[model samples]
Target: METPLTANIKPGRRPPDIKAYRKAGGYRALREAVLKMRPEEVTQTVKDANLKGRGGAGFDAGLKWSFVPMGEEASGPKYVAINADEMEPGTFKDRLLMEGDPHQLIEGAALAAYAIQADVAYIFLRREYHLSARLLRRAIAEAYDSGCLGQGILGSEYSLDMHLHISAGRYMSGEETGMLNAIEGRRANPRAKPPYPQVSGLWGNPTVVNNVETVCNLPHIVNNGADWFRNLSLTAEGGTKIYGASGRVRRPGTWELPMGTPLRELVEEHAGGMQQGYRLRGIIPGGASTEFLTPAHLDVKMDFVSVEAAGSRLGTGTIIVLDDHSCPVGMTLNLEQFFLRESCGWCTPCWGGLQYAVELLTGIEAGAGRMEDLDTLDSLAAMLAPGHTFCALAPGAAEPLGSALRYFREDFERHIRQQRCPWSS
Candidate 1:
């Protein structure tokens, strides 16, 4: 299952050697960019491609790189952190790239270091992803031994040093700034904006944090040029997306498809449709933290702008579809339980609101919900939105609950009205 850049990889198997990857033109981009292309040109290429962070925010990647200072101070010993803490609920897509093609990530990190004039790179692996950490460490040692990481790599003055840092295995560590905090060995809490990570990050150095997939796009962008990469978009936002599938499906796995591919195509054509007896009911579109999309939105193009226009986002591009006969309240309850358990306790909203959410959603699912309970849930989610919490955890928790209430209000009402689940036996 290969695309332009990853075309040589075998399906369901880990990628091949660093030498083979290089033979197939892997580190060529890093070498070329660091030695020939200007750092500004690298940022311009990314801008032309409209590459968004594959993390949840969908922030522009090129713009993020542009935020780095080009002064003499920024030219040496700067940093690039790979947010490999892939712990978002329903977001296991990064695990695939990490476990399968470790060198792709490493070379991409090297290329990013060149683009941003950074020498230090770190991959923040989650505690649970021990296997990914092991594999990446192996690949990093291999890169360094092969002279791709040490000083004067491939006979160029430009050098990139990669390091592996394991997370404490918390969900908050996935947020960009919180990840920065975690990487610094500080308590993982969201930092205040107006001084985003680019301005000041990772031990007070100019840092650029990118998702595993976002950085992995670099070699392709450099090798094929930005226009070729941008042309991969099925919508206005260019590049491919990796979609993760699970539950009530004939086959559930990650596949790289053109960005903005339709939901119906992903479900029906790619996922092999529903299981024997199930029918498509809705989709989470990104991760469980994202809002749900009803069957009416099956035609929505899977991109930042289109998913937003469809009243959701293309966060992480992992689509968790719900089939008919599944209880929506139960689905939300399971996710809320996760949010409650994974709260970093850095704020009241995520810490306390998640507890309340579990209780409220549990009462609804248990047929004990009061009429006012729905409003209570909505109000809580409202209070937890942007600027309320230190980071996006609380707000991300609210996305699904808010959308569930909006799109499935009647179902919620019926559960309360009948004091029983319609889908239950």
Candidate 2:
């Protein structure tokens, strides 16, 4: 398959050194942007390409860059922060990119920094990604030595300083403002928008936070025209996505497939179908936070709009498969438990509501559930939906729990009536 992002990645070898990356045209986009394209021109190209954030939210990448104040009003220091804190359950695509293609990220970050005119850029990585963090640091040093980064980059007037900050591995820091707080040595709690990141972030100056995959698309978007990038997708979006799979699949890993590929193809083909003796029950189509899609939804195209049309969000492009032998109540309980533990306690709903969800899900999984628990879960999901929480944490948790209750209500009822998991036999 023609994989854009992983094209240069060779298996069983360390990530390509700076020399190899340069030979393969790694920093070409950054140099072009610094020497040829204006900041606005770069931003406009990305906008035209319709590049969406790969960090769950499908916001247009170029449109986001355009939000940063430019020229004299953008006086003081600006920043570009890479949200490399790949903390979402079942999402390891960013870690794969960072570990297997660090320079790609550096080059992409450079292009984004140039677009936003950010002198300083930060990679807020997850603490668990020690190998990736080390690889990224080495790549950044190599970039500096080659003059692809640091003062007077590519011998152009543009200069950029890049830094790496390994986080304490909190899921909250994956949120943009919370990421800003972590980078600034503050607690990893999300900040209210409106002095949004582009206007006031990273020490009260303009900043732009992009996901690792989102930034990785910049180099390609700059090298190829926007039209070409858009054509790369199987749908309306631009470029390929690093879709991943875990749990019960014969071959569980990530691949750079064209966007809008059918969910069935991803599981039955790319992931090598379910393991022997296991039948597909449902799938969290985009990580643990998205709604569960039953086998009936396997035909749905895996893209933001299509997934939404099918009653789910294509978040992170990572799917966690649920096999027939696995109890949906238990699986949902595990996910809700994670959300409960990771909550920053910023708001009443997420802090309190997630805890309530965990308790209810635990009871249901333990075969002590009441029929009323179904209604309670439904009402709780509504309460935690987007607007009710300070951040997406609770709402995200709501998706799986809510959907499990809807699509797998019989599973919950079976546990309650039988006083044991249906799969236990």
TM per candidate comes to: 0.96, 0.98
Clashes of each: 0, 0
Candidate 2, residues 1-425, lDDT tens digits: the string is: 45769978877789999999989988888888899999999999999998999999899899898889999767559999999999899988998898889999999999999999999999888899989988998999999999999899998999999999888878998988888898988888989988888999989999999999999998998998899899999999988999999999999999898999999999999999999999999999888789999999999999999999999999999999999888888899889999999999999989888888888888877778888988888999988889986678988998998999899988899998987777765
lDDT of 1 at 240: 88
lDDT of 1 at 338: 84
lDDT of 2: 0.90
Which candidate leads the pack in lDDT?
2
CA lDDT of every candidate = 0.84, 0.90
Model 1: worst 10 consecutive residues (lDDT sum): 1-10
